[model samples]
Target: MTLLPEFITENGEHIRLMLVDYFPRLVTAIVILIVGIYAIRVIKRIVQKIMVQRQFEPTLSKFLADIMIWALRILLFVVFISKLGVETSAFVAILGAGGLAIGLSLQGSMSNFAGGMLIIVFKPFRVGDTIEAQGVIGTVSEIQIFVTKLTTGNNQTIFIPNGALSNNTIINYSMAGTRRADLLFAVAYDADLKRTKEIIQSVLTSNNKVLKNPEPAVVVNDLTDNSVRLAIRPWATNADYGTMVSEVLESIKLELMQAGIETQPFVKESSKK
Candidate 1:
């Protein structure tokens, strides 16, 4: 018991010496970690401000700023751990292995994350932009890190994977201030082309939503087996596209009927091949 007591006294002294030697390093590391975290936040905000000044997409800017912060924090943590005398190379290797495991387990998720980054960087489309993608035409409500939300014309909400959206072709209809409304009308083969053109042109001109700058066009598009197809194209503001097109179609039909234009039996018996 006396020997045990003596041994304990010596071991306790050694323990005290170890603490005296390591305590400063521990405190230094903790201080650096806290300071580094604060610095990272400041840097992130600075980056975000710069991006905003550059007119970068808001979603992309914020996402990239967060990535920058997390990456810096990770690097700072490694430095702090190294300052405490931990082998950084082995720690990095372990981190790499863990990351690889996570990556494998969440391959789809990683793909989405990477795709989201690409979208935010390239900015093919933006939130609130009307887009046609993946067989759905809708207004983009939000651009998230993993998915994009769309509000369809029918008021249905669609959640599209960022991976798919990045890979697919997105038609950004709202990118341009104005959109061309293309209307196709099938008329009787015997219909007077001159009269039809005049009628449609008059209707297009009367609609206040149609822009006169680019000018509306009514042309004989194609002579199909059943009828002569007339293409009526008018330019309108993005917000007025859907309503203007619907109004134009209805107005044209009413005008043609009032002018004694016949739509049924488009190909007369004598005109059919």
Candidate 2:
């Protein structure tokens, strides 16, 4: 019965020593973690602000900011673990091995990530630009870390992998600011070619959307057995191109009809048989 009190006292002393030795380390690690997290947030906000002031692409800015935050978080974790007396070299080696394994498993994804970095840096096309790539024509809606999203004219959304996008030919329609619309109208073979050309030219010039600098052109494109194909070329800003084409086509049809010019549809030699 005398030994029981001594045993309890020894155990209590051991626990007190353990707490005295480890509690401060624990508290210090937690404080460091809290402060580090707050610092990371502040740094991220500052980086974002700097990028914005420098006119960086929003997608690129956000991506870079996230990468910086994650890297800092990883560094802070290493510090935190080291403070708890855990060996960092082994942990870092394990992390490296795991990263290598993940990288090997996601070769395609890594390629896409590289391509995305290339895009963010080179900036061949920006968000809201109309581009034709990989047999898809649409306005770029978003540029993500792995893919670029497009909104088509028909209101369809497409996700294109960045790896293929960077490697492929990209026709950026919006970059030129102005687009030449090639419109073809067929009229009867016996129609007054001069009057038809004049009518088409008049229709193009009357539209406010058309650029006067380039000057609209109406040329005889081809002569079919049944009709003469008139090619009308008009330069308009990208935003106005679609509307101008539709309006000019309708106007030309009306003007030709009023002038007693008969419009004809082109018939292929095989179809004529």
Highest-TM-score candidate = 1
lDDT of 2 by residue, 1-273 (tens): 889888878798887898999999999999999999999999999999998887667876887898899999999999999998888999899999999999999999989988888887788998999999999899999999899999999899999999999999988998888988877788997898998888888888899998998888888789887789877888889899888877887888899899999998642221000
Q: Candidate 1, residues 1-273: lDDT per residue as tens digits? A: 699888878799887899999999999999999999889888887898899887776776777787788889889989999879898998899989998999899999889888888887788888889998888888999888889899998899999999999999989998888988766788988888899899999999999999998999988878888788887888899888778887888898899899988764432111100
Report the Cα lDDT for residue 60, model 2.
69
Residue 123 error, candidate 2, Å: 1.9
Once fitted onto the true fold, the runs of candidate 2 whose alpha carbons sit more than 4 angstroms away are 1-35, 54-60, 83-85, 266-273
lDDT of each: 0.84, 0.87
- Show the colliding residue pairs in model 1: none
lDDT of 1 at 263: 68
- Give the number of colliding residue pairs in candidate 1: 0
